[model samples]
Target: MRRITLTEVGDRAGVSRSTASLVLRGSSKISKETARRVREAMDELGYVYDRSAANLRHARSMTLGLVMNDLRNPFLADLAVVFERSVRRAGYTVFIGYSGDDLGDQQQMLSAMVEHRIDGCLLMPAAGTERESLKVLGSHEIPSVLFARHLGGAEPYIGPDNVEAGRLLGRHLRTIGVKEAVFLGGPSPSSARAERLAGLREGFDGRVELVDGGLTDSTVSSDSGSKAVSRLLGDGTIPDCIVAYNDIIAVGVTYELRLRGFEPGSDVAVASFDDIWIASQQVPPLTSVSTHAEEVGLACAEELLAQIDEPRQNGQKLIAPSLQVRASTGSWRPRKEDR
Candidate 1:
């Protein structure tokens, strides 16, 4: 048997299709008797209301897309919570997608969000996702705010000042008389990573030497940190300090160091970025740079909502960084010869 049609139910109810539709939508304008008649007809015809189909007629879906590269990182997890809460309070639901730092997956998620007719999006683009690849959203006229990893261009972006975050770590390490250090984790060829490296270079500025232990993996993760430390141990060239791309990687770095008979703060020093909630909960606690994920997420959501309202391409937000000192990194005295 074919599916029951709303028009047939209207005919059975002795009412016009529009009036029946109003009754089905629970419009106060419809009389109780008319609504009851429509309901009876619907029950008789076994018709089911398709709310999504009804929503397609509206000017807005009251929905937003939230796409991220990774969820394992607590920073992103916290960001998602903040963004979702803010949007929800404004009467919007969120469609969450994780691309796992893959361009293909990101594209698929964007396409689906477009198909669903979401009003806007907040994206942390996957690694290697060029600006052109995200043109799908623009072509569909879906306003978006890029958070964390940006793909560049004049589109709206809300993220941390990575260079400043790096500077915070670098300056602290230098002040503590660190002579040699290693920067670990983070995906390569990334704007955020590059900025941090530049800031570190400036902060060190001939005061501290660095061991070139950049990305051992394509993306930032605890596994990458563990592998980088493992290789460094095999080389028997331990730096005075290790700076992680984020707290997730710091967990691995600190754990591996201790497992290999080296203390985190006493034997060597460890510092990281993204002052996640767990950063201060670690065994030694974590010395980190605060990206303020909550504020960033809220800003990004507000920016997108504004874009959806007025459609601006130049919207941008850059959050400042602050340092969180912890036992993981200890201040050392400068040696007489070095001083």
Candidate 2:
């Protein structure tokens, strides 16, 4: 039979895992009636509270768990490989798990990692993850470090400094005399995109007007980029520059521009984030921000390992990003011909 998870108990009791945990520990914070509900739920589920076994869970397991939503993402794919080397050199093994960015899958992954008693966990949380969802880790006193995305609460997080990336692009645009820009972004309600835009505004210093491309829900790809740019052009909302969410999106934007007979480099400067492998291979080559994928992996491994040694972890480390300027954003000039 499978072990009864705290998440299941919490679900049955209509309380959070933290609340259920407090009931197990006899914490005074829980009301008598609430505690009764949790206790009864535990009894119904046949939970075994082996305190000694729980303590031994924190002992060296010589293994770590890594969870991510997507392995296809180049940066994350690179991170997986680099992070393994970083930890393996430190005399540890890593177990990689994919959550498909789904909340249910994430819950299961975390539970499995806990059951295995991995020494620590490195997480790139699924989209729409709440701090409450991470209560499972807390309930087990597991050392977990988040990367690439932040989920509020006091968890250690590591990711590229997106705001600085935006600043780099913005400053570059200013040098080229760009008075207006349309930012093509993916995935709505994203902290990274918001931070980048805020930095861009600061970099522009009120000199350049910013337009929202309004295509955040679609997957980041050449096709989405082409569609976003096509819609912008159809609305007669041409700008001096196009800022894409990533290299793939930028490629699409450039393709759509060429289809409309507008030269990407000469007529409209383009830039993107994530100086991926293909960024330099583009027709005019892309201008992008290098998040330094290997460095991010190393930094993330450092944090999770430290947290495993001591559970009280410092929160949030932002790795600096650098801009790689190329032909794409070099020589944009207003077209002489009218539409």
List candidate 1 stretches off by more than 4 Å: 1-58, 331-339
Model 1 root mean square deviation, Cα atoms: 12.7
**Candidate 1 per-residue C-alpha lDDT over 151-243 given as tens digits, one digit per residue, 9 for 90 to 100:** 767768999999888888899999898898898888876778878887887888878987668777786778788889998888997788998
Candidate 1 lDDT (Cα, 0 to 1): 0.85
Per-residue accuracy of model 2 over 1-339 as CA lDDT, tens digit each: 888888799999999775676687676667899999998998999987878875665468798999987787788888888899999999999988998767899999999988887888999878778888887787777779999877755678999998898898898888778888999966656667787888788888888898878783446568889999999899898788999987878988999999998888888899989898999999898889998888889899988888776554465789999999888887666545521
Model 1 TM-score on a 0 to 1 scale: 0.80
Residue 48: error of model 1 in Å? 40
lDDT computed for candidate 2: 0.83
